[model samples]
Target: MSESSDGAKDPSAGTLYPGESPRVYRALFNIFPPYLFGGVRVRHIADDWTSVRVTYTVRPWNRNNPNRAAFGGTLYSMTDPFFGIMAYGQLGRDYRVWNTVGNIEFIAPGRGTVTAIMELSREQVDAIRDATRDGGKSITDHAAEIRDMQGNLVARASQKLYARRLRR
Candidate 1:
């Protein structure tokens, strides 16, 4: 397990919900209305909240009209939220974290299932914590690649997360 300078464990070593297991969280996230409707599923969330893997499928209802590929919005949605959640979990309850910006560039038409794996390294969590230690705000950028089952890149997504220590 990785530790921060302030002795906080790595993102993978912390839980978003105090007593809930990661598996349970993943299950709940999979059924979230937006994800369910968009054919996005949370396949796995690391035990410590450091990493997440999500899958988006191009079903008939979710496919684009002309190309019949995965919808761009859904692909972008699959890359959203995970980074902020990881940063918040690693930073603990005293800090606020939010995704400030998100962008996606489509590399190919996703005709089948595409997976997005998002991870926050211990170094990244520590950097965010250090940057906001004086209660000032910090923004960290993260990137993820959405890949098809055959390992072909389908899209590249980037997210900027803002973090600040909450004033007591």
Candidate 2:
């Protein structure tokens, strides 16, 4: 776990600082222990931390469901960390961010490998900054879709985040 080149700390479980290479954030995410055990791999992330793609393969340990489908818990868990992580990265060090709410709907049973992509657009980031610029906190909702290898939607999740600037 190296710090970003801009000397920005990744807020414990966070991403590289602005102007820092995307590779550093990717490396930190790839080696995350829960991701490794869950077979969830981050496929890509835009340099500005606006978007992230992740893939999860069902393994024997995680296939303990009665139908041998990917466990709903694992599906939910895979989407859990990305939002707050991304916000902290893009919002910079002067702010505090936390992934406060998560809800998932299992649309279809998932077998084999699956993928979920989480993205926070530049406009959205700007909105958050604007909403919180006065040091007031903001709570916002974000969504991600988890699809199976066949391009079928298996689950959808809504994650709400809390963000506010640290009062000096």
Candidate 3:
């Protein structure tokens, strides 16, 4: 069994090479409805599933606010899928992971394009693995700060996911 950076066995490695399926998944997910409708674009998905970046562009129809800012809904929508998707990719099919909770805080009016970076560190992954090793589920929370082109904070989002090992 191949070991991940966190020293957990890669349960799906026998079928898919590292980063193979998820790369395709990331590509296809970019055009999915929530992202397409919100004018959100995925900038990148790192090979190891450690980092994913998303960008949102302000479009005319989506902006009706006084300042013509990017809709807060769009900002929130751009972040909706990352945590769940990343968890599935990282944990593979051997682990059942679901995004159980979510929330967003608008920090400022967003104009032009904004980016959100979601990262899952090895330490965090390891902690989750430890928590779920006893066959019970674990809830893990991840957060990201969305920033404007000028690197100013535009929003803060948190996602909580439930993960547990699957039985054959």
Candidate 4:
């Protein structure tokens, strides 16, 4: 029940203990092809979380603002779609999962190569499985953040997943 600076439950505490193996993170990257941006590379992944760091190059489509910065939508789109994937991966085959809804906040223009980190807890995973098993309906909420190479917050996303226990 660790809490974040915002006073909500800390998302990374249980799923990723300190110094966990990188192999686990690599496996998570494979689960969601959508999160794998064409040029993005996963610098580190651990616990039940993954982080993708982007390397920038000059591209006409990426330049949206007068400053020749990365388009805000491009930045957000790059940051999206990973939380639900990680949540389902953590839940394993015990339940069927799908993204239901999401909300995003863009804090600053993405100027350089960026990073998106997604995480979920073991308790959250179990709750989704149990809720679906017991009530036939499960709604789970998860969050993620995108940051710049220097670790400045660039975008935040919150996701809701609808899950159901698969009938064998």
User: Which one is best on TM-score?
Assistant: 1
lDDT of 3 by residue, 93-157 (tens): 67877788989998898888999999986567667767876788989888999999999999999
- List candidate 3 segments past 4 Å from native: 1-9, 13-20, 65-67
TM-score of each: 0.89, 0.84, 0.86, 0.64
lDDT of 3: 0.78
Residue 68 accuracy (lDDT) in model 2: 81
In model 1, where do residues sit more than 4 Å from their true spots? Answer: 1-17
Superior candidate under TM-score, 2 versus 4: 2
Best by lDDT: 1
| Model 2 misplaced regions, further than 4 Å | 1-21
Angstrom error of the Cα, residue 123, model 4: value is 1.5
lDDT of candidate 3 at residue 82, scale 0 to 100: 73
- Please write out the lDDT profile of model 2 over residues 1-168, one tens digit for every residue: 223336664353233455455577667767988777778788887777778888889977877568888888888877787787778777777778888788999999888999999988766766777788677889999999999988999999898899997786
Model 2 TM-score on a 0 to 1 scale: 0.84
Instruction: Assess the local accuracy of residue 16 in candidate 2 as a C-alpha lDDT between 0 and 100.
Output: 42
Clashing pairs in 1: 12-48
lDDT of each: 0.85, 0.79, 0.78, 0.58
